[model samples]
Target: MFDLVIRNGLLIEADGVTKADLAIDGEQIAAVGLSLQGRREIDATDCYVLPGAIDPHVHLQMPLAGMVSTDDFRTGTIAAACGGVTTIIDFVEPKPGQSMLEALALRQEEAKNKVAIDYGLHMTIPTWHANAADGLKEVPAVVEAGCLSFKMYQAYEGMMLDDVALLRALTAVGEAGGRTVLHSETGPVLDYLRAEALAEGHVEPIWHAYTRPAPLEASAVHRAAELADLASCPLYIFHVGCQESVEAILQARSRRIDIWGETCPQYLLLNAEEHLGGPNGALYVCAPPLRSVEDNRAMWHALAQDALQVVSTDHCPWTFEEKQQPDFTRIPGGVPSIEARLSLVHHFGVNQGLLTLERWVEVCSTNAARWMGLTRKGRLAPGYDADIVIFDPARIKKITPATLHEAAGWTPYDGMEVCGWPRTVLLRGKVIVEDEQYVGAPGDGRFIPRRPSALS
Candidate 1:
């Protein structure tokens, strides 16, 4: 007999939705057909059975500018469960001169007994100098250890890499059959602009957006795409917030470059005008700050047209106190969206017809699974992991800090109305969330071993 079955739900997929009953045998989907029988059955009439959402970008317990993010693995994964995300890929960031292997082991230890859902990690290469190449020789070891992607920053002070280093790292990773993801923003230009802003006494949150203009991002993206082409590597751009950057990415793709673009809900929904709302606006401070409304519309169209492959929450949450600094630079640069990502996307994308239900599943779940190398976790087909979400499309809720499970003191999308909500969430055939309550325990999550990417 099967372990459990969900009956009569419209199963959403990459192409369309199908009415079927999904049976779970142990930790995997055993069957997907009409009238599947199991030891236990839950009726799901009128609900959409979607593969559990996979958030490919999240920062749990990340340290930045002398402050650690408020949400640790437990709170972060719990919030993810409530929002229908069964698997998350967090980054393994190492300090300058720190061994990548040591950082990976330490990060895994921190998340081992704390996370409440399945997780994978992307390793970050902070210092990629001439000497750094010898260190990166261990990359293949970690790729064998399940960390298949590497992140390089082009903007942040300590984490940023020079173009030479970036090109070399990309070449090495490409040769190793791995993917390279980049945070593309020109550090020198940003430094100059920030100094100009500070000298002009324009230190407010709004000036943060002014300092990092769209052209700088586009310039960096253009340069990175060129470097990826030269290195013969696949590129993944993170937090794409402007049409200028999208145009750059599209141009690279037009040349037949294997590059993927990722945008977040803040970029797709919120505009730079959010920065004009006084000190409270500092809550939205993030790298590659929110962009124009025109860019928002462009991001929506890009997703619908298949130009952008994934939408994730760069969910690095800081507290209200941490964001209350007088200078814009002192304000922690991130916002919490893990709990609101799927809802906001559904409310804005599918409900408004900017995205079809199938595209919704694709961007939020399946595509992420494919891109991040989570082969078994992103589909509802038989033999896939039984990570599922029963979504109620007719449900409506106003987002509020009091209602959210994130440890951040507030939400940037608070008071925003959303239609669809996850009614039930299952991780590996085990119910983790029901009726908006988290039923999973700490350490229930396991590290997912990912295979090497085909892009290389």
Candidate 2:
């Protein structure tokens, strides 16, 4: 007999769905077929059994502008477990003069006994020096350390990389057999616009979107794609937000470039004008700020057509009071949706008939695992880790800060009604969440060592 069995559930995978019983042995899936038996069984009648979602972009306990994101590894991974995300990949940012390897070790120490679910890390190259053999020279060693992906920014002050430096970094990572993830936005353009806006006394939250418009993002995407093509690197763009950017990705793919794109739930459902202009507007102050309603429609279409491959939560957040700044520039920018990503995407994407159930599984789980090299974590098949979610499509939930496990004390999706909440979640064959409450403790999670991207 197996260790556990989930019987009579509609098993969903990236390519299809079927009604079957899933058996778990030890910490991996043992079988998936009719009449599976186990020593312990969970009745999953009228539910969808899926590979737990994998969010490849999140910023728990990240430091920025003299403050830290409210959710650390423990709280954030607990919130992620409650949302059906069984695996997450967060970034490692090195401080001034710190080697990428050293920073990674420190970051791992911080999460050592804290995470509630399996996790991975992506090295962030805030700055690089070729002559001094700074960050670029360590690419091979870092990749060998199991961080097979690296992140580069095109917009932040201390984090942005120039074109030459970006090309060098991309080449190094590509040669080391890893993928490059980019936060693509034109830094110079954003700086000029923000300066102009502040000079004109337009410090309202709305100016945040006004200063970083769609075209700026599109241009930066095009540039990044071109550089990736030149370096022969597999590229993944994060938080893509507009039609222009999608068109750029399409053009790049048309040239047979190996590239992928990701979008967040906020960009697909919340619009700029609606969420960025009021007494509570500070809550929506994230980078590459929200777009128009038309842009939202475009985002859905892109996902349906496979122009975008993943929907991750940038999952960085501060308390409500911490967001109260005198100007948009001073406001801590991020949205907390670690506990709401799955339900939001299901309600809006599947319930609305915009995304097929198969596509939903692809974007929410499988694709992220494939692209990020978490081979055993994202599929519901024999030999894969038994990280699963039993989703009750009939259950309805009205979102509120109190219902969430995030420490941020607020949510961008407050009062939004959604269905298909996770009735049960399993992390590595262990039940971690049941009936929408987290039953798992901190340190239940193990660090995952990843391989090079499947694209590589």
Candidate 3:
């Protein structure tokens, strides 16, 4: 008999959903058909059984401005698992003198014993210098060690790469059979704007949006896309929040460039106006600060029109106390969204008719796995990993900090009610979450080795 079976559920996939039963043997799907038999079975009537969501962008235990992000691997992956996200791809930052391979080893060590769900890493180059090319030349070793993507920043101080550095690194990564992921924003302009805002005493949280305007992000996207094209590299832009950025991505794709764009829940459902509310507004502060309602509408249309291909949380949670600073620029900028991401997408996208169930799964899970070269993941079929979510479509859960698993102690989406919730979550046929309670061990998660995608 199969190890486990889920019966009487609507199986949701990228192409469509089917009323079927699923069987799992060992850690992989053993069968997907009518009336499957197993040693143990779950009654999934009135629910949707989807391949577990894959959050491609997240920062667990990230260090920023002298304070570490509150969500360590244990808590962050617990939140991910409880929310039906079985896999997360987080960044691996190489110190100034550290080789990419060294950074990957250190990052893997950090997550190996703490993450409660499956995870992967994206090697990130913090800065470029005389030995930058030499450091990147080892990218093939890192990719061979299981990380197929590299990240470069064009925004943050101490992290931003010059155009020369970005082009060189992209070329090296492309030559290494890896993808180049970027954080697109003009760093100097943003620095100047922040100084201007502070000099004029525009220190409120709302000024965060004014300092890092949409045009700056768009210009950076255009430049980065051009560099990727010139280098003949595959590019993936993360946390794109504005229409102009989307336009830049589309314009590149128009020329047959291999480029993919990602936008987060904050960009899709929240607005910059939230920063005008009060002291609490600082909680909404993040890089590529939230944009206008027009931008939000444009993002929904773009996702529907296939102009944008992925929706990740970019989940970097910090505490409320961490965000109370008068200097908007100094406020720890990241919002807690992991626990509510899947439910919010279901409520707003599928339930509201903005996206079909198939499209929702594609953007949240399938596309990420495919783009990241997670070959056996992001689908619900025989031989695929049995990471699955039993979602109760009729359940109503209002988002609240007290109910969340992120260590941040607050949620930007507090008071928002979502229609669907993950009733059960399984990682490779082992139940990690059931009835919203975490039932997994700290080291239950395993490291996922990734291969280079053909997009390169």
Predicted candidate 2 versus true structure: per-residue lDDT over 246-271, tens digit per residue: 99999999999988999999999998
Which candidate wins on TM-score? 2
Candidate 2 clash total?
0
For each candidate in the order shown, give its overall lDDT on alpha carbons: 0.89, 0.92, 0.88
Please, what are the lDDT tens digits per residue for candidate 1 over residues 281-341?
8888999899889999999998999889899999999998998887887888999999888
lDDT of 3 by residue, 1-456 (tens): 889999999999999889999999999999989988999999999999999999999999999879999999999999999999999999998777777777788888999879888998998866753235466678778889989888899978778888988888888888888898889999999999899889998888888898888888999999999999998888999998899999999998998988999888999998988554455788899888999999999998888889999899999988878878868888887887887888888899999999999999999999999899888889999989999999999999888888788898888788888899999999989999988899998898888998864232
- Runs in model 1 deviating more than 4 A are 128-133, 453-456
Candidate 3 whole-model C-alpha lDDT, 0 to 1: 0.88
Better of 1 and 2 by TM-score: 2
Could you tell me the lDDT of residue 395 within candidate 2?
91
Per lDDT, the best of the predicted structures is: 2
Single out the weakest 10-residue window by summed lDDT for candidate 1. Answer: 127-136
Q: What is the TM-score of each candidate against the true structure?
A: 0.98, 0.98, 0.98
User: In candidate 3, which residue ranges exceed 4 Å CA deviation?
Assistant: 129-133, 453-456
Q: What is candidate 2's TM-score against the reference?
A: 0.98
Q: Which stretches of candidate 2 lie over 4 Å from their true place?
A: 128-132, 453-456
